[model samples]
Target: MVKIKISSLSFNYDSIQALKNVSVEFREGEMVGIIGPNGAGKTTLLKCIAKLLKPHKGVIYLNGRELWSISNKELAKILAHSLFEVPKGFNLTVLDFLLTSRYPYSKGLWETEEDLAVVEEALTMVNAKHLVERKMEELSDGELQRIIMAKLIAHQAKILLVDEPTVHLDLKYQLEVLSILRRISKTKNILTVMTMHDLRLASIFSDKLVLLHEGKIIAIGKPQDVLTEENIAKTYGVKVKILKHPKAGLIVIPLSTL
Candidate 1:
């Protein structure tokens, strides 16, 4: 059930190393959160996985096939990437925007009934069915995030790579989006990987956390193991109070700097 296996992955921006010899594996139906401070290679890792960035060293295997070896058309059928910001100046309607995800499997210039059905289902999954007729330019940030997620769902990719999915959302929508992602991961058996700065939300929603520091993985495990006080202090230079919430389970409270 291992969906992605990255070994000794390394990437650089000219002389500056963005990701160093990092190795990780993600499995089906698992929602993984990648967390780190600025300049920690979190975004780099996601880009590598999405095949948007070619690593200078190391290899990435998606479902046992070398990621770089897969053609872009074929890769698009199995992998999807969502960015933190919505695209600008697009005049497409919400439904039309979502239908674009089907292009990998599409033929001619028309969408079949099946494609339309999948888009509708995806919209419902993100609780944005009411926004179907709305223009993408008119939707709020939170609403647009949901629509983007719906497009990913509609793509029906077995693996989803998202960067800072909750970045622009308010607290409520942040949780709502994560909840939708968690449900999609389970229901569709998609391997969901997201970069998040909100440690508490990551801890609560993720089945596993990958903590990166200075381009290397400091820890990878369940939230309790990866978000330890010692790890936080060392990786983030912060002192934190870890408390248990009666309803929400573990809560991370940043107390002060190291």
Candidate 2:
């Protein structure tokens, strides 16, 4: 079944259109990556799916129901978002922060043993069990990113929307984060959608790639099918070569300017 169906979607900020006629469907347990250069509608499309920004036209459905009809509480059950920044005054430890994800179903701002068990499982998923007691501020960029992801795991949302999850992470952490997401999609049957700038990385880990440019979807399909030289050149205004890497399998090299 389709976990998310975005049809004829269009969005605008005043007269400036951010997205135009974008349509796509995400199935359960699929890892779909959105990639494009800066100023492209990658983030806009993600925000639209997360229901953080409403589209001016078209519709978004979650499990065949209108997204708008789903209450916030209900939405929380099916969808969870991981933004780039940590909220201020969040002085909680890694464990404490991760447990907050279960708040939607818990009571009195406290987590029960079941909640703790869930949090522990999330930590183990990211191999973050050792850092559970560390302060959020004390961890490195990569460690903190994993902790946040662990929170989403604890939330247990079927659909996950992440925005530039590896923006501040190092190369190793970048791969680790994406690898974790891919594993989650397979093992947990969660539909994962993320906006990524690392084209090669996205192509390698994602089952499907959606390329957006100039407020529209330029291409969408398997990474091998969608990340073509022609499509890359047209969308980014730069010529690129698509090659099979010896190790990574898919590699994108920007050859020249258009």
Question: Clashing pairs in model 1?
Answer: none
lDDT of 2 by residue, 154-174 (tens): 898898998888889999999
- For candidate 2, the lDDT comes to 0.87
Poorly placed runs, candidate 1 (over 4 Å): 84-90
lDDT of 1 at 188: 82
In candidate 2, which residue ranges exceed 4 Å CA deviation?
87-90, 107-109
Clashes of each: 0, 0
